[model samples]
Target: MTKSHDVSVQDFNDEDSNVSSNPTFESVLNARLSRRNILRGSIGSMATAVLGTSVLSACGGGNDEPAPGPVPQFTPIEKLSFAAVAKSLEDKVTVPVGYTASVIYALGDPLRAATADYKNDGTDADFENRAGDHHDGMEWFGLGADGKASLTSVDRGLLAMNHEATTDEKLSSFFLHADGGKSTLPRPAAEVDKEVNIHGISVVEVKKAADGKWSYTKDSAFNFRLTPWSDVELSGPLRGHALAKTKYSPTAVKTRGTINNCGTGKSPWGSFLTGEENWVGYFARGAADDAARGDKSVVALKRYSSVQGGASRHGWETAGTEDKYQRFNNSKTGASADGSDDYRNELNTFGYIVEIDAYDKTKAAKKRSALGRFAHESAVFGKAEAGKPLAVYMGDDSRGEYIYKFVSEAVWDAADASPASRIAAGDKYLDKGKLYVAKFNADGKGQWIELAMSNTAIAAYAAYKFADQADICVNTRLAADAVGATKMDRPEWCSVNPKNGEVYYALTNNSARRVDATGSQVTVDSANPRAYSDVHKAKSSPQLGNSHGHILRLKEDAAGAAATGFSWDVYLFGAEADASTSNINLSNLTGDQDFSSPDGLAFSPSTGICWIQTDDGAYTDVTNCMMLAGLPGAVGDGAKKTLSYTKADGSKLDVDTYVGKAPAADTLKRFLVGSIACEITGLAETPDGKALFVNIQHPGETTAMANIANPSKYTSQWPSNAGYGAGKRPRSATIVITKNDGGRIGS
Candidate 1:
């Protein structure tokens, strides 16, 4: 059954109407032209007036609501041309006036005693302890006053970054064959071990200069890298599960390093939390393995989709028979029912948020199993209030998944940052919190249904048998499904408003959504808000799935993440505003806010500005994926607006609730655009807001090996473009942005 609601006028009221008092576009342009006294500027001055009039009229009305004031404009401090360097052969990293960046670390960078010096040319023989490939999300933690683990020390800090996954030939030096395809066979035992070690998190200490420049301190005592091979312990709910047991560790209390570490979070007590994403694809399980074990439940089979003898994408099983290498295979070969030696349960070990105390490397990191397992993208925490339950919001980055939140069992204490604190903080707070999955009802309101094992629906699920609360926690997806939680478009990254406690999630995309299929396909729901197939923009890269994603906002009751009920609405939809007015383009976006496949998300605590970064392959025609900054109004600001879309078949598809108007440049603006073939991910801000750190991942990504030698043949050459010739291989780097006059960013 389809449900629809009427738009409300109260939803369009701008919360910042009182403080947003910038000049109109025409006035600003006239002021600049008058100061410059340029003939060309005067000739185009009239065009600006016409556009400004339209924008002013749209934002102004006779209704009781206050009009949105003139849009704020920023004058560039400086536009530093691309630096000319040999490292950046293919791509470019554009910096505004007074800002600069460098490659602090990369794929083959050495991390331990095994590899001392790194050969940036990709000829390193040992990578087991080296930095992993495809660096994604990261965090920066300041050292303490005693030169220990302080959260307030600005001069010295630790940077923990995740290596999401490796691109085929880039998996290792030997994995790439001469034919340009991966060697179907697995590597030797040593090679297998190396791959495991490279697939986790890289933790290093960085020191900042008096002038605000940051660099890695290789000799820092606290600097260390955690990989899949590192021995780690399982904490929280599933610590002693039979599935977690292995010959290497019979207790099941301890496991190994995390894999597919993606979006990250930081603890109030000064620690790092890295999330495991798409971890299920790493194991290979034969379909017959489950049946032979006499465990053929539909739920088990569906959860662990093992159709063939094994599904090892990296061919790690071909390495050796040692449990270390063979554990990647989930096929059952033993006759015993215990299955203690088998890898079938290895898949369960991943998909949890692994917590690492960067200050004390000797401490063992714990996987907070309380947070349900599904392609976890990130964990964002709400502001920590002393003596209040600590709230954390997370996302499962899969099509048609649900968002999750966890409230600590114990109230937060500001004094807990001391060294004497035990795992007690994690044990008392994170381990026993109530895990709630979201359900957006039809009335624009949502409920946080508890997925605890005590819940009857979760306890009686027919799929995988839930023996107890621990089982339900380990199999959180099953628990969430049993309670009929509302499914959403791939919930990727989440950011909470420190100012008002509002939660925002990136609904990346969903291809399974259809307009007709009533049961399986996603229908038009209030939170989802749209159902239409996306059209491909590039002929070579056909956009098959829901590529252009959108953003969702949830306003908790009483302005707190601990609130059980919340109001939700579609904040933005990715579309080429100039495209067809039908299904493909629902949001009437202009060039300013129009973007596709929103991924990484972060909010500036100082400015209360939400920065939305994109990881898109859908709309590459107009420009590469870009980042947009917006001053979001509260959740109900546009709750009553409706949008009408004309479909490809010439029929109309109507949508309700606040998504039709163009944001004034002051409300939302394009802060920056990235270079070609790069995803603008990972953001960190200094405490004083004096410097901003941003990561440029996988530049020159589309370049071929044959073009490696020629700078002109590559797609980008960024930092080195300053004065050198083009065509240097692009090196992924962390950029430091600061105002020339040392003012706060976006201030």
Candidate 2:
């Protein structure tokens, strides 16, 4: 659920709890001053859990296309062509000299031929047939001219994007209502309907015109939505699970919808895997609900940070007593111990990786529960070998949560890459996998600990006794905790470097990080090594903790993704260009490459370029959330470095860790700076790399609900400001970026 301590969804983003303890160690960083011209100097923590040592060396994966898409050959670019874009605070997107960004799809953009256009005032309805709000993680599935999935089409494809959530600060999501909505309890049914429909995922067909411009079809045959009310199945280990039973489906065979979908995954056999995040904030549980459920149930419920009393996110449950509304109230009201008679177990139905075949509308969406659920960000498959078990890398986007890898029981089969039935292929590889939580050590090594009932730690966990495989899957966080998995920063988006099999993930900044332990916050660890005050907050005092997050990369043991051990290093430490060289600016970032809160990361298969996007607040006064293009080296190219930090007690503490090799001007640089109050996320590229699709989420998000009547007081009116829609109210949209000469982007 949203933050319980009266914080806005903007800062919290559904990272349920806070963590506060600083680690003890030594580190020295090499910080740089310029973004476009620095070959910064070397830098780099913790004695983690005892684990076997494993060696990792970089191996460029053979150009592979797992999904049924055009397999464009990748030639790693040794240098970038465009000059770095300058930082800006403008209300419009800024890009380099030769690139053009065009808006193709946006909030309320009609997907059905009969749907009405979005008026952009607060009165729009029929969101089910319109583009949903807050576009986040997205994937591209090629469409051949024959109107089927293709491996050759670049100009035509289906863009499946996650809507994530609606923007709200006060108790209600004001942007969707006619009068900024009711702030108190007991929301209206009409308002709740619109809010609920906009928090899922949308798949629309987009194509390029002869003029080289991209736009979405109003009624593409492949267009559809997996809304909160859509029928879905809980598949894999959680199929027919007792905890999944609800009034809607006593047998636990089905559920209503997917909500708060964040990161997305592209299935090798052609499907869209969307992660359900922050769904906890949508349901409200009565204060007495916890007592009724008793101690054991409360432990799992509270661990998920679901509020026990009063308000639910936007007061969605207070609309009416209909099953549609009542399901939002996760209170124990029925007598069935299996939870078959009430919606008390409704919360357990979410927090999963739901897979849908965008190309095949005949199949229903299925939540693949075998992938241990948490605040899942994005799931990226490692380089797939024809005979090896596929490994899917994932990160729980909440603070101090664990990173995970799911190794399928089935070996890769090239014939299944374009399977006769994508859904059945999902059943083969995704439904049967061993989930492992990552534990990174101070010795620059990491191990994957299995989270199964058979594991001694999980079997004898003193906290909560897991009953079965389904129990372990449902209460994955507890299983991870019992196994002492390394707690991390806010791990968000992750991608496997197509140039090298190494995996890199963004540890989005955590407000809960602290030099001293308290609550959910913890001290600096080797994997999450930075803890300092952010000096960029102009109106308030500097914020403490890892205000500017870092990017961490790990290499799977030599046997590839199926291996249990790995080596790791800090790829890049996000910071302001002006931050200290020895500590905060560990990566020596220059103005051109400097960024904060790396929330979205992806690697281009056509160019082997790393795309980094930010969801930041600490450095917003200086710049809006932006995207950068990077050419990353292997995991351990840089030398070891020691870092020193000052604790609250006025004493210095030292921590040592490995740092990735420094980047030259051409290796990493800012590519685009977004509109006012926006998060630059959801990246996808054509196989040829000629078109880069980016999702600009919630631009002008700071507009006060009170300012609904005063358009001038609105923080942003983008897409509209940039000339796309009707009103001045900003709308989240997908923008396509292309080079002027129609060449591969980042070439």
Q: Best candidate, TM-score-wise?
A: 2
Cα TM-score of candidate 2: 0.92
Give each model's clash number: 27, 35
For each candidate, the alpha-carbon lDDT, in order, equals 0.61, 0.81
Tens digit per residue, CA lDDT, model 2, 1-747: 122223544333645452212122222221111112224332111111111111111121122223345367888889997878877787888778777887888999888778887898889999998899899999999877667787677888889999988778667777788678887778888988999899889998888766676778777768888799999988998888888899999999889999988888898887899998777777889988878888587888878887588467777788898989999989999998878888988988889999999987779999989998788888899987999999998988887777999999999999999888999999999999899989888889888999998899889988798999999898888888887777788789899998889999999877765656555666676777777666553656667778788999999998897899999999999987867777678888888889999998999988999999998887788788999999999988996777666655666766677888878898999888898889998988887889999999988778888888888998887888677877788888898888889899988
lDDT of 1: 0.61
- lDDT minimum window of 10 residues, candidate 1: 49-58
Per-residue alpha-carbon lDDT of model 1 for 570-643, expressed as tens digits?
67777665544443445556554567888888877656777788777666655665667766766766535543
Clashes of 2: 35
Judge candidate 1 at residue 630 and give its lDDT: 67
**Model 2 accuracy (lDDT, Cα):** 0.81
Model 1 Cα shift for residue 411 (angstroms): 2.3
